[model samples]
Structure formats: C-alpha cells, structure tokens
Target: MKLLLFDFDGTLADTLPICIASFQEAFLQVDGVEWSEEEIEDILGPPETEILRTYTKHGDPEEAVECFYETYASLHPKVTADPAILEMLSALREAGFFLGIITGKARRGLDYSLRQLNMEGVVDWTIAGDETERAKPDPECVDRALQQFRTSKEETMILGDTDADIGAGQNAGITACAVNWLPGFTPKPLTLTPDAVFRSPEELRFWLYRQENPLDG
Candidate 1:
C-alpha cells in the first residue's frame, strides 16, 4: 500500500494501561466513582470529552475532562511505544509510504501521546475522533484522510487493534488489517473479519514488506 493509516491507542503504542488508569482517576476524582477497566473500554469509541459528558454523574463534564487530561499526562511517562513499531514506521516512511493516524482520541490527547512517545513528525496526517462528525465504524475520518492524501482505497490500508478500526477501514473501502500485539488486550467479537490479522509488529512489518516487494518473497 502507498498510504497507511494506523489506530493509535493499542496499535501504535501500549497506552491502554495509562488510558484506563487516567479514566479511573478522572471519574474517581470528579464523580467519586471507581470505574473498572472493562467499563472504560466499553465506552472507548468516542472522545474522552464526550465520554466524560455522557458518563460523569456527580461533577461537571468539562471539569472531569480536564481532570482526565491532567491524570493522563501524569501517567503518560509510564508508557512507551515498542522500538520495533518505531522502526517499522520509519522504514515505511523512508520507502515512500504516506503514514497517517486515524484514532478515536481527540487531537489534544493524540498530540500528547505523540510527544510523550517521541513520535512527533512521524505521521504525515491525522484525523482525530473529534475532528469527525461520527466516530469509527463510520467512514468519515478515513474518508477525510483518503481525500487529504489523494490516495485510492486500493492503494491504502488501515491497521488497528480493534474491530471498530477494521469496520472504519471496511466502510471506507480500504484494506483492513488487525494486530493483537499489546498484552492483556481482548477485543470484542468483530462484526466483520479484517483482511489480515498480525500477532506482532515484526510480523506486520514483514507482511508489508512482502506486499511491497513480491519479488523478494
């Protein structure tokens, strides 16, 4: 593929732990409620602001959002991207592939993670959850990226860690690839199977290399 779109949280970086911790802390601080990791994952498709607005009971949603950001930033240093993922991204970029991110995170959170993980300037474009009228499983974000990159669906692929990411890619008529490299991640049953499923970053890198260099394979 000439253009690659990646999902951020569980795919590019191992930020799910910190994300869960941040949400739990935000809710506990704001609403005096302790949310389980499953509870947080159940409501993960939308932006954190929307989640806080919809789920916070005893406090102002805006305040909860702020608290979430504060907690997230505090916990961010504990998470880091796998070196192999960084290597794969760099290789793809150097090979003339346009790399982008299509994430359920808001722009602020995405930017923060990029900076913390030392991934700034790695992606050519990004479409955050709040940037689109609808979240994943809707094609709006993917469509926008395709438009911006001027790449056809046949020349692009979307790699992610969850079914929503696959659905988004499918809805946008692009190849959908799934990776389950992050430990302890158990995604719900996919409504549609992905075009390919990879077990690790290295596996994915090799697969993409084959796709790009069929003669080498």
Candidate 2:
C-alpha cells in the first residue's frame, strides 16, 4: 500500500500559536525570559531542546524541557485542525492509503491533539521527536514508518508545512510536498524543493490520489 506520512504541528493541526505560547510560558516561568514573536516562530520546527536553548541566555535545558511540556499539556486543545482536514484524512484512509505522523511534537502533545480532534483511529502510527533516537530533518521516523508497512520510499510521500518536513522526506528518499496552508504567509522553502507545492488540502487530495495510483496519474 502507498504510505502517507504527515507532520503533526503546522501541517495537520494549527498548534503553532499554543506551542509558541507554551515555550514562552516556560521561559518566563523558569528563567524570567521572554521571546519576541519573530524569535518564537523562527525556532518552532526544531527539537524542543533547540527551541529552549534559543530562548535562554543561561538556563538548564532539562528544566526548560520539563517546563515546556508542563505548560503545553495544560494548554492542550487550545488549537484545532482546519474544518475539513480530518474529513480529507478520512477520505485518504478509505482510499487504501496508510496514514501516519512524523512530527517534532512530543508524544503527549501529539496524543492530546489527536484525541481532541477525534482522529486517534484514523492514524496508524506517530513518531514524536522524543519517541525516536532521531527526529525530522534526519528522516529516521519516515524510514521507520516505511519499515512498519514493509514498503519502500518509492511508495511513500511526506506532506508538511515547513522546511524540516521537506528535509525529512529528502533524507528518507521519498517524494515530498510542501503544503502552504496559510495563504500570504511566505516562508522559505525547505533546503530541498519538494516534488509539489499545494495551497490547500483539496489540491493535495488530487495530487495524493494521483501519486497513489500512478497508472491513473
């Protein structure tokens, strides 16, 4: 079966605001530091430790990580998916595709969001940043999903909204698509250009089915 590997934050759900707020809360509560919006957005896609380090002049990385989780967990469900995203995902699942997540979010954070969105059943697997030895931009999670389904990268596609997602797909040797969910919000392309760029899920839907059935493509 063709595998569709998705990135959680910024892709499936709109958790960027809560994530930035949680990190800032951690920084303020733990170290009396505050980050500008630009700073927060700049560090959103990397590991939690990296985001913490960027906000700190001198502080314990472990402490910041703990605080981040604590604050984020308390703020779960504050953000949600686009109205049609879950339906689109369901259609893809029923279309004979294996659906999974590869995200920089922690397991607890990802789980909470998935549960609130009532999507735990549709997703087959999720590899959180802390769940594996390596995270996105490294592609180990994507490869892991490929292995789980006994499929090859040739039969896989990674859809995400950031550069790290593109890097992960490149690392795994799979086709990648850069999804621009927020129109007029321009960010630099991932270091690698994706096979396609889509502005909406409907656009991605057509592209995915085409990729899934190459003869029909």
Instruction: Name the top lDDT candidate.
Output: 1
Show where candidate 2 strays beyond 4 Å: 49-63, 182-191, 212-217
| lDDT (tens digit, per residue) of candidate 2 on 100-150 | 998887677778778876778777778887777876788888888988999
Residue pairs with colliding backbones in model 2 are: none
> What is the lDDT of every predicted structure here?
0.88, 0.78
Candidate 1, 94-114: lDDT as tens digits: 979999999999899999999
Worst 10 residues of 1 by lDDT: 182-191
Tell me the TM-score of model 1.
Answer: 0.93
Which TM-score value belongs to model 2? 0.85
Each prediction's TM-score against the native? 0.93, 0.85
Clashing pairs in 1: none
Q: Give the CA lDDT, 0 to 100, for residue 206 in model 2.
A: 83
